[model samples]
Target chain A: EAGVTQFPSHSVIEKGQTVTLRCDPISGHDNLYWYRRVMGKEIKFLLHFVKESKQDESGMPNNRFLAERTGGTYSTLKVQPAELEDSGVYFCASSQGHWTGELFFGEGSRLTVL
Target chain B: GIQVEQSPPDLILQEGANSTLRCNFSDSVNNLQWFHQNPWGQLINLFYIPSGTKQNGRLSATTVATERYSLLYISSSQTTDSGVYFCAVGDSNAGKSTFGDGTTLTVKP
Candidate 1:
């Protein structure tokens, strides 16, 4: 089975620019999640989607960051007017279930905001 | 929110040696997972062990949920094992999983 896949494995943009990262989860998976890892920091959750509706989004950093999952198959994280601190690796994960299932992660999208 | 901490923040080992990485969570969790972040920045699932013990090849993991801690054992380590090992845990009531700072393991050949 195909695992989670992300696009634009690496992105470089100037501060204040906009960049969008996309993730395609495995087929039939209902739970999708987004996480980010800043340099020298732990990976942190960003948001979660159960099908097309957002289940939780408490981890979103600020108003400049937005995430959407339309039709429940793929997700997009957009950072508008990105700041230097936003440079990091963004990961997307999916699981068959919410509570007890294993999570499969994608090859992270590395964003470098300078 | 649950907090996950991984120990021996950094480790270096000679190939063929063995090692153990530890993770401690602040609260009871319904999901606990170990992942290896390779040099290419891919998070590969190593184990999904919330309780009890599980072994896969030379790698084994044990989670004492009552004590809120987990241990991952790597036997006969190889250079390919060099990477960052992260432990993530999720509370039953939360939809998201909290991750540890990760243990950076370097296995020298």
Candidate 2:
């Protein structure tokens, strides 16, 4: 089975620009997650989706960031008016289910907001 | 939210040496996992050892739930082991995993 796949291995945008990162989870996986790691910081969870519905979004950084999973498949994270601090690696992962802790992660999308 | 701590923020070792990295949690009930982040920034799941001991070749891990700590042992470490190792814990009731700052291991050949 294919692992989780992320689009645009790297991206660069102006501070006020908008960027969207996409993730394709493994086939038949019902749980999807979004996480990010800023420079010199630990990777932090952004949100989670079970099918097309959000299971938890407690870790979303702010209102400028939005994530969506449509048709219970691919997911997209959009950052509006990106800040310099938003430059980092955004990773997406998936698991067979929520109860399982074994996560398969993607290569990550490196976002550089200048 | 529970606090997760990893020891030895950074480590440098010879290729043939063995090393043990530690992770401690302030509180936990269920589920603990370890992952290695490569230079390319891919997070690879190494183990899901919430309790007891598990071994996979040269990499082994043990978690003592009673003591709220976990240990990752890399025997005969290789240059391929150079990366950041992270520990994450998930609360049984909460279902979300809390991640540690991670230990950066550099293995020189």
Candidate 3:
């Protein structure tokens, strides 16, 4: 089966600009998640979605960051007025509805905000 | 939020050598997973071991939930084994995990 896939493997944007990263999860998977890792930092959870609704988004850094799962098949994370510290690798992962399985992750989209 | 810490932030070993990586968490977890991120930046799940032990090929992992720790064993390491190992812990119900900083492993041939 095809694993989770992310678009625009790399993104470069000026500070204060807006950028969006997309992720297409595994077929039939009901759980989708977004995570990010800044340089020299651990990978941190951003949000979780079950189907088309968000399950938990407590990890969202701020209001400038937004994540949405449309139609429950794919997800998109957008950063508005991006700051230099927003540069990092954003990863998308998915698993079954039960959420007991290992998370299948994408190669990650590296965002560079200058 | 729970706290996760990994030991030996970095490691370097020759091919054919064995190494152990440790992870300690501050609270109880119902879900624990091991992941390997290759140099290309793909995070591949190695094990979903919350307790007990599991083995896959030359790599194995053991999670002592009672002690709130886990260990990943790499035997007969190879150049291809070079990457970052991350330990993630969370509850099975929520599926939101907090990850450790990871152990960067470099295997030299």
Candidate 4:
């Protein structure tokens, strides 16, 4: 089985620009999630998805960040008008919905907003 | 929301040495996982030990959900083991995983 894979391993953009990161989860996995970590900070949960439906998105930072999982296959996280504080590593993960308690994570996309 | 804390924020060991890392959570958790983040920022899953104990080669992990804590042990550590070890737990109530700050290990040859 293929592990979670992320696109654009690294992204650099100016403040106020927009960027979108993509994730292709393991096939047949129904639970997908997004997480991020700023420099020297613990990784923080961003959201969770059960199929194409968002199960929980309370951890999202603000309105500027948006996520979508179309057809419950892959996911995309978009950041509009990004800020300097948005510079961090964004990771996507997925797991089988059977409470197997295992989540496969992507390599992560490093975002640097100058 | 749960709080996950890892101890021994940083550790330095020589190759072949052994080390233990601890993780404490604020509440009950149904799932706990250990991950190794390489220098290049790739997270490699080490264990999905929610309870009991599991061993894989030179690495082992135990998560006592009853005590709300977990432990990771690395025996005969190698230079390839130099990286950050993270502990993440998923609360039964929230269904979301919270991660600790992680333990940075440096193994010198």
For model 1, the local distance difference test gives 0.94
Question: Each candidate: what lDDT?
Answer: 0.94, 0.91, 0.92, 0.93
Off by over 4 Å in 3: none
Q: B1-109, model 4: which lDDT tens digit per residue?
A: 7899999999999999999999999988888999999999999999998899999999999888899999999999999999999999987677579999999999999
**lDDT per residue, candidate 3, B12-108, as tens digits?**
9999999999999998888899999999888989999999999999999999999999999999999999999999988755678889999999999
CA shift at B5, candidate 4, in angstroms? 1.1
TM-scores vs. true structure, each candidate: 0.97, 0.96, 0.95, 0.97
Error of 1 at A45 (Å): 0.6
**Tens-place lDDT digits, model 1, residues A65-91:** 999999998999999989999999999
Query: How many Å off is the CA of B69 in candidate 1?
Result: 0.9
Give per-residue CA lDDT, model 4, range A47-87, as digits (tens): 99999999889999999999999999999999998999999
- Runs in model 4 deviating more than 4 A are none
Note the B-chain TM-score for every model.
0.99, 0.97, 0.96, 0.97
Winner by lDDT:
1
Model 3's DockQ score: 0.73
User: lDDT: which is higher, 3 or 4?
Assistant: 4
DockQ each: 0.85, 0.65, 0.73, 0.71
Model 2 over residues B9-104: C-alpha lDDT tens digits?
999999999999999999864888999998878888899998999999999999999999999999999999999999988786664678899999
